[model samples]
Target: MSGLWDIRLEGSLETLSPFCVIAPGAEEVTRANGGKYRRISRRTLYRDGLRDSRPVVPGSTLRGRLRRSAVEVVRILSGERMPLAQWHQNAIGGIKGSDSEAAFDVQLRITLREKNPVLALFGAGSPWMTGRAAIGDAIPEGPVETDLIGGARSDDGRRDGMLFERLDADAAEQWHAMADANAARTRYKKAMRDLNATLRAARKGGGPEEVARLEAELADLVRCEEAAGLMSTNPVSMPLLHEAMPVGVRMRHRMMLTAVTEAEAGLFLAAMNHWMRSKPALGQHESLGYGLLRGEYDLWLSPAGAGDPFSVGQAQALPLGTMTAEPIAGLSGVPERLAGFMAAFREAFRSGAFDFRLASEIG
Candidate 1:
């Protein structure tokens, strides 16, 4: 039931924790760092001339993440037999023919491989035609502000786990030193006061000058104590940290399609459903509980205004609006073909034809 329809997905990408989706160019960076990150909040460039005041999640990033997530659904449906190498072979058709699990029937497409439905959906290989799926970058719908969080640093030095360790050590030592020295400090202050009093009463030469010097020293000690107290309260948590993207920013991705069938649309939405339903995160600091997002998906059979539009929502929440009339959904010959493709793909995934890769296994 598709014909000249566009899919406009509107919903808030509610972040469970602070998440960041920053690129090298516009990210707030440290001086001499070459690439910017943190240091300050700045607008992020989604593409040339499309800069957002807050960092926006890139569509490519989301697509990659969703694709990887779909691997998990494939794995669970297949029970853990599929590994990364084999799984990609099935999805992209790198392996030989007998692989019934291969998503793209490369052997079948030798005549017009570019016309392969799955490859055509994701724009395989390039140089022929644009991808059928028109996924767009997600931007915050409301005000977004940055926050700093210590994330376990990566092997590449994006964040250093030891940074927190060292800070903790220093804080502990300083706190202990201050606690132990508190009595001594009090005694020293009292003695200085007594000496100054005695000198004042004696009216002796050099007494005022010596007392003044002692007073200055006492003032310095007081400053040290204050500093130690503040440092002791210093956050001695994780070491690796960065300026994180603001959480709670609403987002929407308007995916417009020129002509796509039910199977293609179903497979695409099903994969995305796995992403939204699952708790895997997007962007950086995933371990530190950042990038976790929850959203809804809505499919429109046609652009609004072309008589009432037929639509379906993943959940009760529906993000609706008028989109361009250039794109449309195909109604004929989609389900049967796409269903067969999906079944084989799932079978291959489940039968270990495609080895699924988890985030933990990623380098």
Candidate 2:
């Protein structure tokens, strides 16, 4: 349990439609007075002594949101009750206590530092699961222009489905490819069957002339089969139906995580992959169709005591050496120490063992 990684995610994003991140504004906020919310970017000014990039989505928010998404995945996989939002902040914001009737004061206070996989990956027993991973604020690669619209509501629950049924991004392309391949396969089989039937009838019935005609027809069918095979090899590509996208949109993101076990690290990677593939995040105001991006992450793993782990020089898609945690002896008493660390392991990973559900989560 030593080799931990500093993972970096780089990608570009374009919305399927005009959307907003929902910056705060007054009740009477209007477009003219600057009271209306607009898109933002990570920037800074020299006016402040030591400047810091005021991010469109800060490191804290990025980490927390991703962490929450990860936790949700872990929760489903592990069957733990990791809430999605909080005072207790989760990316799926706006939480009023859970379905539990018990008041906050009556909630149990015994913080058990078990060697639970989720807790070890993301922190638990606190309002925030500041997990093992730390994601930096996404810096913009281009301008983040905003557009105004009305009738924004949260009733449109299935944004991902809408993405396939609507826009033609990578996700939509995937769906279309599957459908077309199935149809092409069906058509090819029917043509082959017709050719065989014609050949059988000609052989059973006629003379040389008729047999020659059937053979010629069979040759035509063979050509059709060849064409079908070619089509199968290279299906007609659909142009991305992205009339909703605007110009100059992309961002770069970086993240680092420490994992004592393979499961922990894999969990983090899985969560990020699912989130991006789903295009769930770009910023806030998702209900109005804001924040959907595509990307893949690169990883660099180093031993725990590596001199300069922060300096990620030439990290690849996987870890350098495989690291595995030695099995624990028992689970009787409390007094956590690395005896079964569910604490001290960052905020993201500290809940339960990973039980990922690919169909519902990733697929």
Candidate 3:
């Protein structure tokens, strides 16, 4: 889980100009004279069933691609038949051995709305014009049954169900710290056993002098373990004999749900904003500097709404307005909101809300 977190917005891509040239001999050449506009792509660690970020769509820069993932997650969590994509219908049909799981098809949709109307209409292809690229009107008004490709309707699909209820932020942070601490302790205990085995082997093979030497080593190991606050083996730490511990351990996993309090959601979004705007963003942005054309650059973190609940984050890049950050819930800087988010996800997965299994070490 320890890795760089990246969420970025790239805009102002030069539209490729298609041109044709003809020689006196009647030979013609058609060439493209523009560079691909820099697109928004997220880069974060992929662990468990979700991406490393709070909302989990880094590989996709287009709003349509990102919203597709959201819709899928929501559907999976809701236990409903998700709307199928062009290719998805073939794969998502309830084939027994297919990759598709009827229960895993749930999706969540992410829509970014802007307070400034000018900021809402920036498009790379059309320059100062608002292009209907990804998040056009296609972005649903709270998860409805309007056909994205065609005018399709689903009687079974629930339009807009409130996913999360706002919760305390500070409490959320405390909960995650507790869970993280427990995870670290559990790992420490297994490491101790391996080190202890070395000491035990030395004592068994050597004479009386060796026994004394091994005892000293054993004592040192215990001291180190106690210093790390893992002296006793708690039930939580008992089942730790695994070779692929890093991959199989629950600490490497994460879950995201919409059913969080506004404060809790805010903390998650704020943290993501902080992480994205930090020094790391500079490196990521520099990689796409060419497509940016010329504009003042700065990243800002803001809540979805304190006054109007309908407002969301939108990305716009043009002469009048430009790209904006995603709208996160929770304005109050209470840390507990994070704790609650982590706690809820961990509990749900650990209790088998999702079909995840740890590849425990056999030997």
Candidate 4:
């Protein structure tokens, strides 16, 4: 016998440090100042019959973070050294080879779900399956405040707390090499453009010999450009600016799981547990002390039908505080419920509910 239950988590996240998830195409190099800057991601919404643009942490981004954390949990708890790339594809949905690779294979997908609970929960794309989980964008609870922060990279390593007098000869050599590589990249780009134009003209009226020669030159220029790109580095001693949401910004978020088995729910909850335990960070520049966040959530699990295999009761409240130092046992009101779910996950794992061997068979 099989049963499913619905789970919902309502949450709020507060940034403990500066955070920035840049808008698409918003990071650009300014020709006037030769400086690069990024702007925060935003979406337009209507409120009180008026349109307003607001900063948003995209749902896709949150899903990606959770998926990564979940994969890590799976790795640790399963105690198996499965191929990470293939396992990730199975858990998170990726194009195996072509989009239609699994277009006609239905039994394979059913077998996949039976073997891999993580894949069953998260779904896959090649065979066009729907996932049980859904995450909403984190929208600001109040007015969004932004700050413009600036940083610099010095070739002399002075900005990294190194003294200019102690700069090594290798630093100077690297700087010159990077500069030369950048120059070569620019030259290759210009030459490629010219060659493309010449090729176009040759295709219209010139001989095949001219066309072939221009095509070969353009291909060679492309290879050279790629090589130069690998060696090119950012201009040192220049300021880079980022528009970020400063600390203390609070955002409300929601995640939902529909029609999931206890084992599947446990798998997700276990991942969330690991994520909270590991001090999860979001957005960008975590190394620069940005994107640190504190999360608080109230989880609600709907009751399973009578005589069903599921055991959890209705309306159980689970409060999750990601940054709290208190132990699970020390916390009030919901530790037992959480522990129950975790135990279910553990039992399922012990019973071989999750099979990593199916990873290689998934498209």
The number of the candidate with the highest TM-score is: 4
Output the better candidate (1/2) by lDDT: 1
The candidate, 2 or 4, that scores higher on TM-score is 4
| TM-score for predicted model 3 compared with the true structure | 0.18
Expressed as tens digits, the lDDT of each residue in 1-363 for candidate 2 is 334444333333334434233334412333432223333444563444775543344566555555665656655554556433332423332233344433322222112112333444455433223356566655556444443444322222133446555544576657566656756765775676776777788788868898898788878867876776644464333211111224235556666665445445555545554455443545555664555544333334444444455655454234332211111211122222222323323333444222222111211
- Candidate 1: residue 4 lDDT (0-100): 30
* lDDT per residue as tens, model 1, 67-119: 55544555566555765554553244333335243454444433232223344
In terms of lDDT, model 1 sits at 0.50
Task: lDDT winner between 2 and 3, please give it.
Answer: 2
Model 4 misplaced regions, further than 4 Å: 23-34, 99-102, 155-233, 303-335, 359-363
Better of 1 and 4 by TM-score: 4
Deviation in angstroms for 193 in model 2? Answer: 79
Clashing pairs in 4: none
Better of 1 and 3 by TM-score: 1
lDDT of each: 0.50, 0.45, 0.29, 0.68
Q: Candidate 2: global Cα-lDDT?
A: 0.45
Candidate achieving the largest lDDT: 4
lDDT of 4 by residue, 1-363 (tens): 157777777777777778889756874644344445766787777889988777877888777776766777778876767675666576567565565654557787777776666677777775566788988888888768688777766545434455534777677666567667656655665676667879999999999999999989888877776675643455555456778888888888888887777777777777666655574667788788777666666776664433245535442423342322111222223445555766787788887766655434544
Error of 2 at 11 (Å): 5.6
What lDDT is reached at residue 198 by model 4? 90
How far is each candidate from the true structure, as Cα RMSD in Å? 16.1, 23.9, 27.4, 8.1
**Model 3, position 2: C-alpha lDDT score:** 16
lDDT of 1 at 101: 37
